[model samples]
Target: MSAIKDDAKIAVSVVVHACGRIDLLDRCLDALVRQQFHPRRYDIIVVDDEPNHNTLHLVAGWRTRTLDRGPRLSYVANPGPGGPPAALNRGWRVARAPIVAFTRDDVVPEPGWLAAGLAACDDRTEVVCGRVQTLIAPHPADAQPGAHALEAADFTSASCFLRKPVLERLGGFDERFDIRGSDADMYFRLLEHGIAIAQAPVALALHPVGPAPWGQSLLRVRHEEFDALLYKKHPALYRQKVEPSPAWDNYVVAGVLLLALVSALLGMDIMAALAFGAWLLLTARRCAHSLRGAAHTPSHVAEMVVTSALLPLLTVFWRLAGAVRYRVRFA
Candidate 1:
C-alpha cells in the first residue's frame, strides 16, 4: 500500500453511520484517526441516527484531538431516525470528496484499510468492498460470538467505497430497506446500471462480536419484507443470487407442533408423543448445527438452543408476512 505523501489532497470521504453504543463508536473513531492516509487526504463523517441522539457530544470530545492537518472529522444528526440508509445518504449529501466510503460504528479498520480501498478505485470502478473479519468477544452472551475468516463477499456497506457520481446516479440506498440488506440492494442496482463493483481484499476491517438482546434476532424477520421488495425490484438477479428456496423447514416445524398440540388436546397420547419427539429431534439438530462454530459457553449454548427452536417458526411467520405485504409470493 502506498503511503499518503505530504500535502495530499482530501479526496476521500469516510462516512460512518452511528446510532447508540457510544463505546463502539468511540473505538471506530479512534481507528479512523489512526489510518495511515494523510489526515488531509481523507475526512471522517459520522451521522448520528438515533432519535434525540447525543453522539454529537461524543464527537465533540474527540474534536480537539484531530490530527495536525489530518482529515477533518464532523458529525451530523440524521433528519430523523430513518435508519442506516438514511444516515448514509445524509452524510454523503454533504461529502466533499469524489470517493465516499462507508463502515459501521462497530467496525475497527486496519491502518491500511483506506489506502487499499483507494488503490482499488479508478475511472472504471464505481464501488469497492473490503474484507471484514469477525472478532468474537470472549463473553458468552455476545450476540455475534464467532470467528470469521477473510473471504470474498458480495457488495456490503459494512466496508465499502463508492464513487460520488455513481451514488448520485443510482439515487443512494433505498430507505425501504430500513436496516438489513440495503447494501445488496444498492449493489444490485449498480450492476443493473452497468457500474463496476470492485473487491479490495487488502482493505481489512474487524467486526467485534457483541451481545444482542433476546428479541433482536427475531426482529430480523422484518428483512423478509425487504427481501420481497428486492425480488420485486430485481426479479432475475434476485432469482440468480437468492431465490428458488422456500422456508419449508419453518412450515414443517410449525405443522408438527400444531399437530402435537391438537393430538394432546384430543387425548391421543401416542400420536402427541411421537410428534413431539420428532420436533425435539429437529430442534436438537438445529442446535447442534448453530453451535458448531460458535463460542460454547453454557449461556451461549442455552441461548442458541432456545433461539433455534423459535427461529423456524418466526422465519415462516415473517416470510408469510412479507409475502403478504409485498405481494411477491416469496414462500
Candidate 2:
C-alpha cells in the first residue's frame, strides 16, 4: 500500500457496480487498490445494488485498511430502481474525478490498467474502451451443470471509461435497459452524438468465467427483451452494429412448433406429424450446433438438449414481449 499526499488531485474515479456477490467484490477491490497508477491520481467507488450486512462489512473493512494506503476507496448503496445501469448512474454521479471508469465486480483489472486507460484519453476523447481478456477453464466438479464461459466485445460495460461531463450530458444509462443491451445502447448513443471513443488496448482486465446453473442458456433468453428495446431505440444502429439479422432458426423452430399444435387441434394428423417432425429436426440441429466446442459430459449434453427444445419458444416469447412493451415492430 502506497501513501498519497492529502492535497494530491484525483484524475480518475473507478466505479464498480456490485450486487450481493461479496466474494467477487472483494477480489475486484483488491485489484483496484493495487493499481500501478499513482495512488492519489485515482479513487474507487463500489455501488451495491442489493446492499446487505456482508457487503457493508467488506467495504467498511477495505476503507479502514486503506485509510492511509492512498487511492481512496468508498462505498455507496444504490438509491432507487435496481439494476446495473441505475447502480452505475449513481456511481458516476457521485464520482469526484472528471474521468469515470466503469467495471464490474467480477472483473480483476491489471496493475497498469488505470494508467493505460488514462494515458489513452486526450482532450478530444470522450470515452475509453479497454481490452478485456476472459479467463476460461473447465467447470469444477462442484460447479453447476451446463455452465458456460462469458464473452467480451471490443466495447463492453465490463471495462470502459467515460468523461463525467459526457455522461451527465447524455443523462447516463437508460434505466429501461435494466438487464442487457444498456451498454450497447449507450455506445450507439455516443456514436450518434459524435462523441469520440478511444480504444485502450493496454488497459487490460481479466474476467474469469464463473459457474452457472442448468438451463442457463434458456434463462438468458430473457435478455432478448432488452434487445428488442434497444432495437426500438436505435433500429439502424441495432441492425448494423448489434445484430445484422434476426435469428431465423429460432423463428422457424417457434413457427413449426406452433403449427404442429394447431394442426393437432384441427385433427389433421398428417400435417401435425410433419410439423412435429420438422420441429424435432430443427431442435436437434440447434442442440448440436450449441454443443460445438462445449463440454460433452452427459449432464451438459442433457442440459443442452432440454434447453435447445425450449429456447426457441422462450426467445421468441421474450422478443415479442419486449416488442409489445417497447412498442416496436421488431420480430
Candidate 3:
C-alpha cells in the first residue's frame, strides 16, 4: 500500500462499550495505538458506562495523548443507566465515519484491522464482521475461528462493522438486552429488517473468554430463551439453522447427581462413591479446558476454578433471561 493510499483511506471508528473494567479497556486502547493500519485512517471512541467522573478524565487523558499522533480520539458517556447495548448506541450516534465498528472494551484488534475490514467493503455490502480468538495461556492446539463468512443476515454484533446507512435504519443494537444474547438478538432483528451481513477472514480480534462471574449463570440461560423468539418469528429458518442440543447429556448429569445424593443418604457406599467420582471427572475436564494457558497466578487459578463451577448455572440463567425479556414479540 502506498503511503498516500494509507493516508487517504476512508475513516473507520471503533465504538467501545466499557463499564467498570478500566484495566481491560486500557489494554484494548493500548492495542489500538499500535494498529498497523495508518494512524490517519481510523479513530477510537469509548463510551464510559461508569457513572463516575473518573472515567471521563481517563478518556480525556487518552485523547490528549493520542492527539499528539494522528486520527482523533473521543469519548462519550451514556445518558441512560449503563448497559452494553445502551452504551454502544450512545457512541454510534456521534460517530463521524462512514463505517462504524463495534467491539467490546476487552478486544484487541489484529494489525491489519483497518485494511482488512475496509478491503472487505464494497458499494453493495451493508455490514462486515471479523474473527475472534481467545487469549489463554498454553492455548489449545485447536480453537474455533471467529472470522465468519459474510451473507445476508438479520444482524451481527460479534466484532463486526456496519455501513452508516444500515445502522441508521436498524437504530443500532437493541438496548433492551442488558448482557446475554443481545448480539444475536440484534442479529435476528437485523435479518427481519432485511440487512446484509458478510464476514471477512482477514479482520480479527483477540478477546478473552474464561471462567464465569459468580452466580451470573441464570441470566445466560434466560438470554438463550430469546433464541426461541427467533423461532417464533421464522419457524422454518430457526429449525433449519439451529440444531437440537444433546438433551440426553444434561439428563444423565442430573440423574447421576440425584442418584449419588440418594445413595449416600441410604448408606449405599459403592454406588455413591462411583457416581461422585464420575461427576468429579466430568467437572475436572471442563476446569482443565477453561484454565489452559497464559499467566495465571494463584488467585487467577482460584477465580478460574470458581468460574468453571459456576458457568453452567450462569449460562442457563443468561438464556432464561433472554427468553423472559423478549417474550414473543414476533409479528
Candidate 4:
C-alpha cells in the first residue's frame, strides 16, 4: 500500500456510528490518531446515535490526549435515535470526501487501513470490505459466542467502504431498517447496480465484540423484527445469507421448549418428559458442534452448557417477534 505523500485532499470520510460504548469508542479513536496515513487524506466523522451529548463530548475530550493532527474529526447527532442508518445519513450529509467508508465505534483499524482501503476501491470494486477480528486479548472464537467468525466473503460487516459514486447510486442506506442486515442489504443493492464488492483480508480491524445477548428483551425482539423486515425486502436472498444447519437446529429447539412448557402446565407428565428430553438432546448436539474446534476450558464448557439451554429460545423469540412485526408471511 502506498503511504500518503505530500498532503492529498481529504478524499475519504470514515463514518462511524457509535452509541453507549465509550471505552471501545476511545480505543477506535486512539487507533485513528495512530494511523500512519496522512491526516489530510481522510476525515473521521463520528455520528452520535445516542441522545446524550456526552458521547460526542467524549470525542472532544479525547483530543486532549490524542493530539491528532492528521485527519479532521467531527461529531454529529441524528434525528431522535434513528439508529445506525440514520446516524450514517447524518454523517454523509456533512461528508466532504468522495469516498465514504463505515466502521463501528468498537472497531480499531490497523495502521495501513485507510491506505489499503482506498487503494482497494480505485477500480472495478465499489464496495470494499476488510477483515475484522475480536478486540479482546483472548478473543472469543466467534464475535458472537456459539457462532463462528464470518468467513471471507463477497461482503463484510458495516465496517466496509463505499465509494461516493456508488453510495449516491444506491441512494444510501435504507432508513426503514433500524439496524441489523442493513449492511447486507446495501451490499446486495450495490451488486444490483453492478458495483463489485471485494474482500481485503489484509486490511485488519479489531472489533470490540461483547458477550452475546440472550433472553427475551425488547432488543432481542427488535433485532429479529428488523431481520424479518429485511427478509421481506429480499426473501430468497435472506434465506441464502442467514441459513443452513445452526439456524434450523435453533428452530427445532424452539418448538421443543414450547411444547415442554405448555405440556407440563397441562399436567401431561409423559408428554412433558418427552419434550424436555428433546430439548436436552438438541442442546447437546448444538454444544458439541460449537465446541468441536478446540480444547475446551471449564468456563467454555460451562458457558456452552448454560447458553445451550437458552440460546435456541432467545433466537426463536427474536425471529418470531421479527416476523410478527414485519408481517412476514413465510411459505
Candidate lDDT (C-alpha), each: 0.80, 0.84, 0.66, 0.70
lDDT of 2: 0.84
C-alpha RMSD for every candidate = 4.3, 3.3, 6.9, 4.9
TM-score winner among the candidates? 2
Residue 19 error, candidate 4, Å: 1.2
**Model 1 off-target regions past 4 Å?**
1-8, 51-54, 79-81, 137-142, 145-152, 211-216, 262-271, 293-297
Off by over 4 Å in 3: 1-10, 139-158, 178-180, 190-194, 209-222, 228-237, 242-331
Write down the TM-score for model 2.
0.93
Cα shift from native, residue 176, model 4 (Å): 3.3
lDDT of 2 by residue, 217-289 (tens): 7766788899888998899999987689997778899999999999999999999999999999999998888
Off by over 4 Å in 4: 1-8, 61-68, 135-143, 146-153, 208-222, 244-246, 261-268, 287-306
- For residues 1-331, write the lDDT of model 4, one tens digit per residue: 2233422477788888888778878888778767777766777888888757677788777654445465667778775647787788788777778788788786788988777887788677777888776544343532253222333344654457877777676677888775556666776677666767777777777666555533223234346556777777877667776652235666778888889999999999999999999898889997787677633877667666776677677777777777777788632
Candidate 3 lDDT, 1-331, residue by residue in tens: 6745643464788888888677788877887778787777788888888755766777777888888675567878776866788888888888777898877776787777667877887777777877776664343221211122112223344478887777788787666564433666566666677777677867777776544443343233444555655555556555555534423443454466668889999999999999978766766776677667623566556655665555554544444454566574321
Off by over 4 Å in 2: 1-8, 138-152
Better of 2 and 4 by lDDT: 2
Residue 36 in candidate 1, Cα distance off native in Å? 1.6
The positional error of residue 258 in candidate 4, measured at the CA in angstroms, is 3.7
Q: Could you tell me which residue pairs clash in candidate 1?
A: 39-70, 39-71, 143-210, 143-211
| Model 1, span 1-331: residue lDDT tens | 1234421466899999988879999999999988998777788989988834468878877776784655778888886647899999998998888899999898899999999999999888878989898776554442444224223347777799998888898888898786556876887898888888888989999887766675455665556667878877887888887666666887999889888999999999999999999999989998898777667877778877888888788877777777788788676
